[model samples]
Target: MSDERDPSPYDALLLLSFGGPEGPDDVVPFLANVTRGRGIPEERLKEVGQHYFLFGGVSPINEQNRALLAALRADFAEHGLDLPVFWGNRNWAPYLTDTLRDMTLAGHRRIAVLTTSAYASYSGCRQYRENLADALAALAAEGLEPPRVDKLRHYFNDPGFVGPMADGVLTALEELDPRVRDGAHLAFTTHSIPTAAADTSGPVAGHGDGGAYVRQHLDVARLIVDAVREETGIEHPWRLVYQSRSGAPHIPWLEPDICDHLEELHDQGAPAAVMVPIGFVSDHMEVLYDLDTEATAKAAELGLPVRRSATVGADPRFATAVRELLLERAATERGSAVERCALGALGASYDLCPVGCCPARTPRPAAAGADTPL
Candidate 1:
């Protein structure tokens, strides 16, 4: 742990996330909030909302976030950090704008934001900044003050983040039958987006030259695969697969959805498969619906056993990683080059988000009193 005597620069830490519906009645409204300004029809939203209806219109994300909040508070207290933690979501109750308003009213000045996402992409990075901008604008309209907020760097490369996920895969493998464990195929899953969006995702100059999204996914997949192999002494084969595709059929999205991948493995005579949701921090709706419900059903239909690995939600190591990130960011002087702490053998640094990173397609209204570039 970094020196605790160093005066903490941030007044509070904010847990920023993508929220979900808490009950049956909230499902449509939550969906509406997510699809707002997209001009998506109510009927179409109802069709998409069927997945939530399957589980009584409740998404596990809110409960999971609550668990994370508790863990964060406990960790902060244990470390004797004075920063208070707050929760805000892009689409749900205790909304981001409202949360910011409350924080500002309570006299918080400098705040640090920790988004639930671990990667750099439009949805993962820039959109949240845009949301902050929206929230600040809203506060401004109400004649309120917006506190200055700085978001922490991505933690995808942090050992504390990756190690827990690697351990989860190993545990999943152990749960399978001996034969399956010995030769189970590993399927790493993440969300699928339009090929065009992915092509232009990062801020790297030549990023769109094909395979940026796939390549980043491959880097994390390989790290976990290698770690699992080392720990279990099982040389299981693995592949990167996509899930939760929301685009129309005309716009090509990432291929071999988790369900389809499970079917393919079964056809190839694989007796079992271990699915690691490397793309997410928790077992959110995508993980629940796609892996638990849809893919599990497919696996049952094919008589092939499939084990889904756990995400890094509220994992102790994850909290440590967040602390390390904040400390690293705080230690550096403002306007200096950001240095990324590399994960073992990952061969990449994810320090500062590059300028123009993850451009938004349809920008939302700015939040009231959000900090803006001078």
Candidate 2:
């Protein structure tokens, strides 16, 4: 599968991600693109945009994506995968449509997309597919041959994903003062989606409503904790907490915000803590502001020493994982017997996102589901 002469079934790989502002001027407009139909006021957006403004009005996500792109290209070249990697974002420049146009112009047809989000939720999974659908539709309208896009499966449980996070957690644990390192608690954090969205995360077949999202996170957190325990011989106390909640207060989201969790750990007399941002693939705005800035401040207020581990942005293992996933999918498309790569108890995620998986609140055009591809 790694041989360039063998020819991959897919001609191109698309690195799909959630985009962020590149400059002070791009902050509000980027936020607007993210919250397009939500009716969030400009004033409120400015208030929320303070996170980026604090950092020169730029989001770290774009740079991180660029790094990942470079890493993927390098890995592909080194491994002789012979696939060109293209990048696109959902909410900002180098948009999906533009990238798709470039791919088509280059005469590439079959495409594989690797989204940054590793989970299975409406915003994480379905919304990205919806974006792909929109891009394909636009290309079709322009009389271009819309490519067939196969979204790689959710990789929350893959060793390529978990191994890096485990290493990160270990590094964060080591970063704590030696006196408090043994007593440090692990707070694994992820974006807080609405409870309603949580209720419908995976396929309706085997997994009950919303079970896939929480289950995958729990599995990954357990895997990381176990990996850390095996290496350091410390069974650190840990809990999965949510962050970056954006819905109206009245509407319920995931409970035990990272800040509140820190308070609880402090109350429990935990000497220090390590934040494992297992939910994200990179240190984007949510991670920078929510965890590094806001959560760190709260931990300080509580006198709880804390360290945030690095995200798997452009980690060689992660880039290699992308290549492996692509080949795995290509092998499946070719009807070849290939070992399904995964770690943890739940096993490898389904290659084809099943029918009724990650159902959206409203009907929208989505690609690469059980029946649709675009």
Clashes of each: 16, 1
lDDT of 1: 0.80
| Clash pairs detected, candidate 2 | 199-210
- What candidate 1 gets wrong by more than 4 Å, as runs, is 1-7, 209-212, 334-340, 344-351, 362-372
Q: What does candidate 2's lDDT look like per residue over 181-266, in tens digits? A: 99898999999988878877887854554468888899999998899989999899999999999888999898789999999999
Runs off by more than 4 Å, candidate 2: 1-7, 206-210
lDDT of 1 by residue, 266-343 (tens): 889997999999989999899999999888888999999899999999998888777767766666524434455656
Query: RMSD of model 1, in Å?
Result: 2.8
Q: Which candidate is the best by TM-score?
A: 2
